[model samples]
Target: MQPTMEFLTSEEAIQVDAALLSSKEKFSTRLAIYALRCLKQIAAEKEISVEAVTAQQVSDWIKKDENIQQQLELDSNFELFFTRLVLSSLKPLKQIAQSEQQPIENLTLKQVVSWFEQESKIRQE
Candidate 1:
């Protein structure tokens, strides 16, 4: 289920659109941004760092989230798809944040795109 997620605020969307990334990269950037926010919230609630948030914790949080629960009621498949998407997107952002020694939310679009490019080249090797 590719439900449209309004993860970014209007200002954030404008900033992302102004970046020089391609359409696909922009999508990834948005996912990373959203994942970062989720991570931040989870971390705060758990009293841990964003980098320390576990996949299990994220899944539990998503399941318990009121909005997500409402969506799940409307569509059974949303939880699986959205949970996977958020988890997969979080992978690169987590890596980038660790490599850069910054919080995930502090990562820039350029940093994320660069990480993806590196991963792509590595996969081709």
Candidate 2:
């Protein structure tokens, strides 16, 4: 079964050491990555990173993209799949966190996106 959104802000998971909420955070990060990539392409075309790529750019992009947001937030089985993938990778993630002396939530956007990119590459291979 698909994951329900209730646990995102539910009071229950607060009692456990659960961390699947990060799956939701990753979705936001993916959207930001999409926005950043689009901005970078525009910057490349202009031969300058002169123009400011504001939060408005990303927010507007997402605001107009109801379908994609809907799909990522509510549709398909991706959340379940992503959560399982994360659960399976917990040991390595913890190791990275411990070695770095930080929590998983402190991982930068680039780091998290790199992990996602690695997963994509593995699937393609």
Give me the candidate number with maximum lDDT: 1
Model 1 misplaced regions, further than 4 Å? 1-5, 64-70, 105-125
lDDT string, candidate 1, 4-78, tens digits: 646687866777777666678778877787777788889889988777887788878788766576677888878
Top-TM-score structure, candidate number: 1
The collision pairs in model 2 are none
Cα-based RMSD of candidate 1: 4.3
Report each candidate's C-alpha RMSD, comma-separated, in the order given: 4.3, 15.0
Collision count of model 2: 0
Itemize residue pairs with steric clashes in candidate 1: none
Clashes per candidate, residues 3 or more apart or on different chains: 0, 0
Off by over 4 Å in 2: 1-21, 54-125
Alpha-carbon shift of residue 60 in model 1 (angstroms): 3.4
Per the 3 Å backbone cut-off, how many clashing residue pairs does candidate 1 have? Answer: 0
lDDT of 2 at 19: 23
Across 4-121, the per-residue lDDT of candidate 2 in tens digits comes to: 3331223322322132325554554344333334444444555544134344443344334434455456645654443343343444444444656775545444454555545446
